[model samples]
Structure formats: C-alpha cells, structure tokens
Target: MPPIRTFTAALGLAAMTATLLVSAAEAAPRNRYVQVQGADGRGYVASRNAHRTSSSFTANRSIQTNGGYGLNRNRSAAYGEGSYSGSSQTVFNSGRSINRSASVHDNGDGTASYQRTVTGSEGRSRSVSGSVPYTPPQ
Candidate 1:
C-alpha cells in the first residue's frame, strides 16, 4: 500500500477500537440497593373460610301405652377470629358429648348458674376460667 493509505488505515482502526471500548463500558450493567426507614417486628398470618349445610326429613308410625316423644334439632353457627399482630401465638381447642333424655326432673340451687355448649363430631370440650372474690374485713 502507499504511505498515505497505510497511515489512514491505521488511524481508522485506532478510532474503531476506541469507540468499541467506550461502548462496551457504557453498556455494562450496574446494581442498586434500597434504604429502609425505621420499623419494628416481622412477619404475619391470615386466613378465611366459608360453609353451607342442609338437613332431611323423617316420619314414624307407632303406638305405646307408656309414652312417646320425638325431637328434631337443626342449628348452625359460624365464628371467625382475627389477630393483627407481629407477635407469635399458640392455640388449642377440645370438646366431647353426652346426651340423655328420660322422665326428666330439673333441680336448681338458689345461687346456681347453668351453661350449655355443643361440639361437632365426637370431640371433647375443655375450658378454663379464673376467679377471685373479695373478703370482708372484721
């Protein structure tokens, strides 16, 4: 090649190399991190539920000299609990069943109180309560 052509070719190649380096640097990736403000506690829990139910019918034809009684009960109840807290908690529940119906006789004390509850399935029932009564000074 001629001297002028050789010098021009070298200059062009140098310019191309400089441009490739500049573009490579500019195209490289960069990372960023976020800064958090003041806070306390961590994590949470949540849930929901729904249900529907129905019952059927029945009939009987009989006669007894002694006595006869029939009772059909239909009851439905739904309960929900909501706890919005950052603290951890543990829970447990239990229940049972005992039914009896015959020549019924009820007796009550003057200062007595009664309570009734029902449970699903054959589970057991358990409850705990705390009480403190005041004492009069002599």
Candidate 2:
C-alpha cells in the first residue's frame, strides 16, 4: 500500500511538471519580420529594410502694372506644392515583411490633391539594405 501511494505521488508530480513546461513555452513571444517585392515583381533576398521617397517644387511671379489713373502698382504671387511616395520591407531568413507610405500637399492657389498607398513583400534575406535604397527621409 505504501508503494502504491508513492507511485501515485510521483505520477502527479510528473503531470504537473509537463503542464508547466508547455505553458511556459506558449507564453514566450516570437520574433517577427517582413519583406517586399522589387520593381520586377519578384521576391528579394532575406533582409529587413525601410524605404522612402520625396519631391517638391516652388514657383513665384512678380510684375508691375500701370493703372488707368497713371498710378504704378506692383503685384506679387507665390505658389508651392510638394508630394512623396515610398514603401518599406523587413525580412528574415525564416520569413518576409513589408510597409508603405505616400503623401501630397498643395498650397496657396493650387489644385487640391491627396494620395495614400500601401505596399507589401515576401522573400529571402538578401533583399533588405541598411542605406540608400532603404534610407528614410528626414
């Protein structure tokens, strides 16, 4: 009877230990990543990189006109506009990731416009870069 009691105690201890181990494993967080496709529409090497782009323009005009009352008047007008478009992709040897952004602004007397875009990718480790192609704008 004593041996039976000891065996039961040992079995219960083992079951509890197994449960704790499984729960601990499930509680652990996993590392994640993303990747993006290239201009050719193909997957890139495994890598994690952020992409960006920007463009802007400005114009100004100044003129002098003589009024019918023999009075001289000066007129000045200035206009400016800017826009941007870009995307980002993060990849790991195990998987892929991607992110994208775009913006547009019109000022003064220009037409109103807006744009939004999102891009994604999946591929190997060689695709992401640390600079240049993935350099973010200030």
Of the candidates shown, which would achieve the greatest TM-score relative to the real structure?
A: 2
Q: What is the TM-score of each candidate against the true structure?
A: 0.17, 0.24
Give one digit per residue, the lDDT tens place, for model 2 in 37-74.
55655543222222111222112222212221111111
Q: State model 2's lDDT.
A: 0.28
Return the lDDT, model 2, position 99. Answer: 42
Off by over 4 Å in 1: 23-138
Supply candidate 1's per-residue lDDT for 105: 10
Cα lDDT over the full model 1:
0.24
Window of ten residues with lowest summed lDDT in model 2: 128-137
Cα misplacement distance, residue 57 of candidate 1 (Å):
88
